[model samples]
Target chain A: MQMTWREIVTAVHGMLFGGFFLMACFGVLVLLHRSLAAHGGSEVKEHGRRRERIFLILMVLLGWAAVLSGAYVVYPWYRAAVPPGVTNLEMYPQRLLMSDPHTAGWHTLGMEWKEHVAWMAPMLMTMVAWVMMKYEDGSEEHRRLRAMVGGFALAAFLAGGVAAEFGAWINKKAPVTGGRVITLSQDGK
Target chain B: MSSPREAVANGAAGAAVLAASLGCFALGVLAVAGDGWKAVAGLLTFYRPTGPLSGVSTVAILVWLATWFTGNRLWRGKTVALGKVSVAAFVLLALGLLLTFPPFEDLLLGK
Candidate 1:
């Protein structure tokens, strides 16, 4: 089955956002586990440790996938679509957004938000991963590190949330269009 | 059973590493101010320079530190190895950021 560019981009966006949500969920789970392990039943402590280890690993992997996939799609599309003469992104949002130039303003803003926020995910996720690796659960040192890492994870998740929302908003508000063919001559090529 | 001094030192190092990673993220955002979509896209990658290099470095260094702390014999000499790699990667990331700015791009690439 040959999917249109719109279909393909949408599918990719779905995968991208799905990764973000999963990362957020797991990040929160790991953080909650750490909290519960501090002053809870032994069973819950065991459960938190297990969940922290497993979910942290998953969150790290998904964060990497989202970062790479986002870069792979956004970069090439930007280069190919925008012509040389265009000065600003706002000037030619149609090319970047795959929409009519007339109404590409909001979509352009959304893309900007998506790009900036998406960049925050990797650093935060990796830091949390590093903390998990560095410290044993339930120790004095581990608790300190976990608190810091948990904060980073929360921030990363928020950024991912914004990026995903802006991405969805852009896709829906300005659904991708079948690109136009330009000709040099006065008439059809 | 680490002494308080050792714990304090480790915490300091971890905080520094986290700061460097955050610096890289800030660079990504700042680079976008000068260039446009290309800069934005470049800064979003896991590769060297204007993007995730510091984050990558933090991860590598942290992993080595963690393994060392945990008495993992296999990662011996990783400290020196990672330090060298990080120096090179930071240089590249700096260069990448410089090039992303249009003025620098014009100077280096030549319009």
Candidate 2:
């Protein structure tokens, strides 16, 4: 019935990646729609239209992938713990509590996943923006688009990397151990 | 009436600005890869530990400023499309940082 911290961490990792993937997919969709409207025209070249369509499809697929992966990561825990009679919404509070800071494994997992989502979402969004700008028709608009997307992407990449590193440092300095099963404090002192 | 020499000088100035902006953009990319300071500051408002986050933020801000200045110079007096895009990008970056940091955390949390 009990799960190891490693297993929990792995699940959190999956969730984080999944969340980012989903966020990216959404960003891409937004970019695609905007690009299609802004750049599409009667004079649209065949190449431009083709590229636009490809981006649109790609964003949709990535979004779905993130949703599926995210569900896969968290759903198992939900299914195993929740009783058949109880609905997910009904069991949500307990599940959330179980995942709180006091429970080391759950806490670590939650924190890790949150960090992952934070990093991934912005990074992916930046990438989507970059790609949209890249494929834009070589107009004044295109140049502006590139600068906007590139600037944001650059910012996100910098910010996310720093946050992740900081989180890692904290984890190392104050390692969390679940329950009272193991304690290293007594030996050192 | 502007002479041919003046036109050439103006063209050269524009070229120099573009080149400088491009360089800054490249530097920003490198900083992001290496976990630069601005990146750190942007993310520190979240659950990040204090030390490294501050360091990275310091560096990232410097780089961002350098890039912005270069970009502005390159765009000259005109509101070129590229200039607008660059402004938008900077705004988004600031927004993202805000969302991740303290005051904006509530917004990100759907609170």
Query: Across residues A1-189, which tens digit of lDDT does each residue of candidate 2 receive?
Result: 354453454334443543344444545455544644564453457786677556545544443343333233332333234456765432332244354466443333433233322433333343444345334564544433443444444444444444344334433433322322433356456
In the order shown, the candidates' DockQ scores are: 0.09, 0.04
Per-residue lDDT of candidate 1, residues A127-180 (tens digit): 566656556445554465455556556656666676677666665654443333
What lDDT score goes with residue A154 in model 1? 60
Q: Which residue pairs show backbone clashes in model 1?
A: B49-B93
Among these predictions, the greatest TM-score belongs to 1
Worst 10 residues of 1 chain A by lDDT: A175-184
Model 2 C-alpha lDDT per residue in residues B35-64, reported as the tens digit of each score? 334554454433223322233334433554
> For this target, which candidate reaches the highest DockQ against the unseen true structure?
1
The TM-scores of all predictions, comma-separated, are: 0.56, 0.32
Relative to the true structure, how large is the alpha-carbon lDDT of every model? Answer: 0.49, 0.40
lDDT at position B35, candidate 1? 41
Measured with C-alpha atoms, the lDDT of residue A161 in candidate 2 is: 43
